[model samples]
Target chain A: MNQTDAFHRRIDEALHNAQLRQNFRSALTGIMARRAEQFPDETQLQALRDQARAVRANALVRQPELLERLEAKLTENGIQVHWAEGPDEANAIIHGILERAGAKTVVKGKSMVSEETGLNHYLEHHGIEVIESDLGEYIIQLAEEPPSHIVAPAIHKNRREVAELFQRFHPEIPYTEDIDQLTQSARVVLRDRFANADAGISGVNFAVAETGTLCLVENEGNGRLSTTAPRVHVAITGIEKVVERLSDVPPLLEILTKSATGQPITTYFNMISRPRQPGELDGPEAVHLVLLDNGRSRIRVDDELLDTLRCIRCGACINHCPVYVQLGGHAYGTVYPGPIGIALEPQRIGIHKVGTLTSACTLCGACGEVCPVRIPLPKLINRLRAEAVDGLRAGTAVRGHGSMRKPAEAGVWLLWRWLYTAPSRYRLFTRLATRLRWMTPPWLGAWTRYRCAPRPAQRTLHELAREEGFRNE
Target chain B: MSDSRERILARLRANRPIEVPTPTVYAKPLGWDREHCIASFMQRMQAVRGEVHRIARDAWVDWLAGELPARGIHHLLAGNGDVGDRLASALPASIRLSRYDHPIEQWKPALFNDIDAAITHARAGLAESGSIVLWPDANEPRLMSLAPPIHIALLDSHKLHENFAAMIAAEHWANGMPTNALLISGPSKTADIEQTLAYGIHGPKQLITLLLD
Candidate 1:
């Protein structure tokens, strides 16, 4: 199936799934309420958001220099830093590292960058086993599915589903739906993997330049285990995740956890400076960091769209988005989903491929309001819509796919514009519509499929205004 | 890779947004008194399901000796240093105390599975977040606090700071950073299964902080 058709099918499936909708509704409602309680002082939250925006803006302005400095400092601290222009290079670099280590098994923390690169598939194809250590990620991995949410990968699945999945995969362990027992099962399985894994991979939350530290924020201790247990550790992140000073991390981290999970801090905030230093008993013998650009440079160049890069991947916007709550993350059919995904996916993948993803938004601005970094998400979505329309009209490859716009819809819009521009024509059409209101069709395509169509009033508002002696002034 | 690096950097430089000076916005201190700060720390820690124990400076040894057996903590893993020596000397002969004196590579599976609890010292504490800062070095390996099911952290009251920003600024982390430093707020927990919170997924399920005054 074509991308547009597939998207619509996914949306249809999601809309019909009452259980999925209820799950997301409750989850998002709880998340939103907790976030509100976490930031009781609105003024302080806004001030901190403004400060975060400025920090991100400044970081982008000095991105190249900051990244270079980060590389030098990390190298000085005995870390091997590799730069990848895109996903292919990133996967190749990581695979090369694993090959040199002769790694058969690799443990991974929740790294969205790796997801974007399809690293698990890539490594598996090369005969290297990759295990996700995070409980959420591990559950999804066992089910052979993509994460439905950024933070909570298996949010769409209920405990019963997970119990069944664990039963299917872990036959040795008795089936139990108890959260603690389930968690213990995963821990027992993953602990063995961590002990035996030759290489570990994780995503960096923030890379501090001055201190040469790669910081990871996670509630689960899997992140620490992924980075520490194996002989070789590889950390991958977007080029945009670097900051100038270690001091910059605290404020970002403060807003990150509060906005993401409504916590003052995550359970574990690991600041890794280097591989096990001299005489250090534990930690990876070698630490490698891969900075993946993956079309972020294109985003960096666009003046209007550059603010989208300020996203911290906290999933706050996703939790607050009205369209997202209804449809869930899988409907978007992208690694990153929701308000941020609508704006970002087009840039990362060709706009033509996922251009229809922009239509998923109601443009409700809730995303922008809750965004800790204050990215104007609605404006970016509108921009993509406009670009898609223009691309359709011009048949241009430079813009994202215009395949979503049907010729019939375009013609109707053009006709509506023509009538609206001329008062006489518009009045004449309204009069005709009123006269022939009975002949109006019940089906107005998709719009009237689920709801009643409005009929023309007996008298036009203009005619009523004239009879009432009301002047235009 | 160098070519990719240069190309990526060049593109970034070419597309760099208009430069703005970095903002100087440190978080305001809570300014709570010592007692209030400790209380707040305990409250925050408990909120995340972490256990906090306030002990008089001189009573820690006696407290651990009495508590270990009652808590079913038999095989305790600790750092091979003064702290470990003190713990070993104080604990009763019934409890098995193993000192982490060698590289974890030598006995990875045994260290992670055999120990019931691991005790380590916190470099500092953050009152606002109720987190303990751990800078694991040769003396204290990282796994001691992570591998065991129960993690016992010893923290001094004087080391508590109001927030993360205050602690980072005061400590001058910019000058130097440890190879592996962590700010642990609670034990390993996950709310992944239908949003039901469960502890000890891959790390310590019980995080017991012994706050020394």
Candidate 2:
């Protein structure tokens, strides 16, 4: 099946599944309420968000210069920085580093960049063992499923499912449904991996240009262990993560944590500037940073879409999104799902490939209002929708999902527009519809699939007004 | 790779958006006094399930001596720094202490499996977020606080700052940064499984702060 058809089927399945809907509804509601409670002082939060927006905007404008400066500073600090034009190059660079280190087993912290590159699959295909150390990532890795949510990868799964998964994968350990017991089992299993792994891989949250520091935030200590336990550490990030100064981090960090999980701060916030210094007790001896472009450079130039790059991946937009709440992330059928995903996936992959995803928004503006950096998510999604329509009409193959326009649908829209443009035709059509209201056809299946078809108003509002005016005369 | 780098950089440069100045709205201090800052730090730390003990500068050793045994910390890891050395010396003879003088590369399995707790000095504390900044170096390694089951951070009250941004700007952190700097708020935790909170997944489960006045 094509991408659009598959996307539709996923949505259909998700909508039909009552359990999935309930899970997302409860999870999103709690997250949204907690986020609301955290920011009691709305005025101060708005002011801070404005500042964050400007910071991201300014950094994006000087992205190239700041990137070069970051590279130079990181090089001086003894970090090997590699630039990749796309995911292929990124994987190759990381694989080469692991190969040089003779790393047989590798532990990974939760990194969306790695997911974007499909790094785990690539490495496993090459016969390298990669273990996800984060609790959520580990669960999904065990289930052999992609992450359903950005911050909480396995938010869809309840404790019972996890217990069963653990029991299946770890036959040696006795099965238990307790959350704490499950966590302990994972720790016991991953601890050995951390101790024996030859290399570690992590994603960079914010890369400070002036000091060449890669700041990573996490609640689990897995990130710290992933970077520190092994001899070789490889950090991958998008080119847009670089900030001009170390000082730029505070505001970003403040909003990122609060917006993400309503936490005042994550447990561990690490700033890695270099590899292990001489005489140092522990840390990676060789640290390599791979900066992946992967179509971000193209996004940097688009005027309407440039702000999409300013996202910090906090998942607030995901939680607050109405469509996302109803359908869940799996329905989007993209690595990055939700409001940000609808706007971004099309650009990163192509507009035509994710055509169904582009239409997966109510444009309620909830995501924009809750965004820490105040990215206009609804506006960007609208632009993608417009691009998809234009691409279809022009017979041009758009990037990502490709063109998904039907000539019949276009003709129907054109006929409706022609009738609506003239008052006489519009009135005649309304009158005819009112006369044969119950004759609505079943072929208009998309509209009436989940909802009742609306009959034309008994009389157009314009007709009622005119009749009222004549009676007054 | 160089060609890729140049091409990427050139694309970014060509497509750079209209520049705007970075806002200074968040640069102001949080207006917390010394006592208030300490209180806030303690409150914030406790909220995240971290233990905070405020003691006189001379009373830390006595407090640790009593608390360590009570908490069943048998084997404690200490760095080679003066503060670590002093604290380790002050511990009772009954308590076994190990100084982290060698690189962890030499004994990865033993260090992770054997150590009950690790002691390290925090450079500063942020009152707004209740975080202790640790700039671990050759003397005190990064894993001193991470690998063990329990992490005890010794912090001086005088070093407490209002928030992270103010601390960074005032400390001139942009000039020079250590290989690894950390801002630890509490013990390692996760709510990943159905949003159920659990502590000590891969890092320390307990974070105890010795706030010295």
Candidate 3:
């Protein structure tokens, strides 16, 4: 089996656990509900989202200049900035930094970029101790599983299971079913790591080109501890996070929270401008930013897929997605999940590797509607479907439409081309298909698993109108 | 490396000069009127599984008591110490009423596991989107607003902002503002598993906002 198949099998097996389902269900509902409660009116939130989209668009248009500005300003402000063309380069940069620091212990905040680069595993393989600071992240870390959800990493695990895991992993610590007790236990354990860690790693939510600053927002204070407590702090981020100006921040922040956790704002929005200036209370002595291109520069130039770069990793699209509900994030087989993941994974990685993620969306446009930056996700996915089909066909016309050509040759392509080319012909075929609906072919049931495929509205709308005595003019 | 650094530095200096855009030529009004905004906000709130009430200020305490038993909330962690003190006296002693004033380290875990509901005053209510802004202060631990099963926020009718821009401005202006501010609309929820609707996952199961008029 390929990487995609293996990832699917792992998550599929986990989904059977009733406890994980219950936990995921409750968590998703609360997050969706909270987000709605936070931004109750769609129109109001949409406006904020549009404004944010405009800002992101502006940043993308001037990314080369903005990135250069950010590097200089961040460097001047006492940050060592490194430019990485891809994941390997990013990992190498981080590895080099850690090696020079002689850092044996590292604590990590929740960063999707780190996941993208597979940093923790890389560091651990090299004999460096890495501990996830976020409670949800820590839970998944113990489970030896990748995060299923972005914001709430371990949304798949129940409290009882968490207690059991904690008991087994840390035998000295007592098992407590209480969520708060569990959080406290994790906190106590993680705090020790934070206090003693030689280096801290973080993912930036937004980087300001104007101020050459990095913004870290988190509900838990772990982000603060990760950035401040360690002797050295290194941020791994994609180039897409750069915004044009510091003044443009509030509008983006306004929508990010509402769209993310339905919070008007996150618990903490910490801005690190310069490394701890003299008389500063607490902050890292040295700050470094690894500006990772990682295929985003290519994505930025692709007009069809570029809007995806505007995403703040809010996971709003996932919350509203129907497909994500059934399979979960791990099923997407990539770091980014849900609707955004479907569009992003193919670009960040190779399309063939994440080809299944592209087919996961329902095309309901819920993701596009909910997106703060107005990314036309559904449209982009549709465009990708066409691209994928074209690539599969490879320009050679197949047999089928002309029976005289060759009956034994490839049929799926010829069928698709014929069906898609003529709307009237396809409508007639669908009308005939309605008649054959009662047949209930074995394979057809699997096709209709998620859909009823209602019997073509019985008679046409024209027929119903005619029966109602309206003349067809 | 030196040459690359110099090249980068020169580029940064060239772009360091800020280019301010022309003022928004057409700042369209948010596509909602006052009543419509409130109605839409409430609708979205209900959609996300939050219980919203439009109530009079004088009737607040009685209504709070009435909703709790009906909603099966027996314990509450309230941020307003004075209000919590009053609530303790008003309710039967059998029902636990804990005032939230502990340090973040202590309160975070307590709020997560112990409290049935967490109630705090909202700094601003966005009419356009049924959202409340709660800034973490000395008395209120940031986690208390999130970690619990049910979140109850009191929004003074006067605090309603027409839109989010106004909400941000008001937040910057709120005196003694803590470093962390949260704009919470509903409870913590996700549909990561089979799109099933489950309540009270990582955060609150129920989100209740009392729009005090």
Candidate 4:
């Protein structure tokens, strides 16, 4: 099947699965409620949003400069930094570091960027064992599934499913469907891996340019153990994660946790300035930071589209998105899912790749409204829709911009343009539509498949006006 | 610089976005009096299942001696400092207090398996978020706040700041920062399982803050 067919099949499967739909509904309802609670005052919310948007905008505008400053500071702090132009290069760089360190076992914190690089598969293929330490990540890893949500990776699995997963994976432990017991099993299982792992990998929440510090946010202490317990700590992040100063971190951090999981702050906000210094008792002895630039700089070049880089990966847009609530993240079949996913995936992989994702939006404007950084998600998705067919304005077109444009569709649009622009053609067309209302088809396309297409009225508005003795004509 | 770094930097520079003004600082000192800040801090902390005690600074050791046994905590892992020594001298013989003096490599198994709880010193606390900040050093390792199933943190009342940004400015973190700094709000938790709030998944399951007044 083609990409579009595959996407539709996934959506169909998700919609038909009552379990998945109910899971998403309950999860999102709780998230939306807690998020609202966190931001009780609209005035404060707007002010924080403005502050966060400004901070991200400032970072994007000066991205190149801030990145350089960050590199310099990290180097000064004794962190070894590497840059990768794409996923393969990034994986190779990480592998090379592991090879030098003789690291066979790796524990990872939840990092979306690592998923973008397909890091786990790459390492496993090279005979390395990489364990995901986050409880949600651990659950999904055991099930051999991709994360179904950004903040809550295994949000698709209810408690019974999780207990079953634990029993299936760790058969030695007695089976229990209790939530606390299920969590305890994962803790016991991953704790050993963390304690003995040769290296730890995590994603950066924000890279502070002013202090050369890498900040990671997590409610689970897995992030801390993954970064600290292992002898070598490797952090991988996209180039856009940098902020200009120390002060910029607070507003961004504050909004991120609240937006992502509706927590005032995650349980742990870790700031790593460097590897374990010479005198420090424990931390990673060697710290390596890899900056991946997989088509981000290209996206940043477009003035209006540059807003895509403003995301803090809060997953708030996903929670509020109406279309997303119907189908979980897996239905999108991309690394990112939901408002940000549809908007961003097509950009990373050419529009020809996932451009069909643009069809999966209602544009109800909820995602844009809830975005803490004020990213115009609807506008960007709408732009992508146009870009998918007609292509963006002149030289600014995205990859495979006109690939989805069909000759039949284009012809219909052209005819529509012709008929709508001319007064005589429009009047004639409307007269025919009104007189032939009985002939209107019950089905036109997939849109009409769910609901009846509107049939023309018995008389045109002008005819009614003429009957009423009003004559603008 | 590596070739990839140079190339990536070149691409970013070539694709430089339009200039935007630097942001005006939005995080401000809450301006709450000490009493209000303390109350707010206690409330926020407790909301997330954290235990807090407003005890006099000198009396914290005695309070822990009384409280740790009540919780049935026996093996206490503590940093090799004033608090560790005090716990050693003051606590009854029933509770075994282990000092984190040697390198972690020497006792990884014990740290992961044997220790029941740990006590770490907090650099500051934030009332806005009910977070206790820790900057681990040679005396207090990074894992002190992370590894053990139960963690007890000691914070001075004066270190409570209105918010994270205010604390950063007051600490002048940009001047010099430790290898690892953390803001721990409560015990490690996860609601990933059907949105069920399960505490102490990977990090400390219980976080008790003995606020020194």
CA lDDT, every model vs. true structure: 0.89, 0.88, 0.69, 0.91
| Candidate 3 structure quality by residue, lDDT tens digits, A1-473 | 86447766756765776666666666676666777786766786777676787788777767777788888778777889997766777888898999999889998988999998899998998899999877778878988999887766777777777788899998898877766566656655764576678889999998988667788876565676677667788999988899876556767777787778775554456667666554332356688999877677656545556777878888898888977776677766678888888788776665556655666777999988888888899997776655544434342211111222223333776886798689787767666666665664544454578776444445566557779999946
Model 1, residue pairs in steric clash:
A352-A400, A352-A401
Q: What is the DockQ of each candidate?
A: 0.79, 0.81, 0.05, 0.83
Using TM-score as the measure, the top candidate is 4
Rate residue B9 of model 1 by lDDT: 86
- TM-scores for all candidates: the values are 0.96, 0.96, 0.67, 0.98
Q: In model 1, how large is the Cα lDDT of residue B143?
A: 90
lDDT tens digits, residue span B68-91, model 4? 899898999989888898888889
Model 3, position B82, has a per-residue lDDT of: 61
Model 1, position A367, has a per-residue lDDT of 95
Lowest summed-lDDT stretch of 10 residues in model 3 chain A?
Answer: A396-405
Tell me the lDDT of model 3 at A192: 56
Global Cα lDDT for candidate 4: 0.91
Off by over 4 Å in 2: A391-402, A422-443, A470-473
Docking class of 4: high
| DockQ value of candidate 4 | 0.83
True A-B contacts kept by model 1: 0.86
lDDT of 1 by residue, A1-473 (tens): 87778899999999999988887776666888888888999999999898888888878888899998999999999999999988889999999999998989999999898999999999999999999989989999998899999989989888778899999998999999888899899988888898899999999999998888999999889999999999999999999999888878888998999999888899999999999887889999999999999888778887778898888999999999888889998999999999999999987887669988888988889999999999999999998887776633564323455645668778888999999999999999989999899988888888998999878888799999999999888
Which candidate do you rate higher for DockQ, 1 or 2?
A: 2
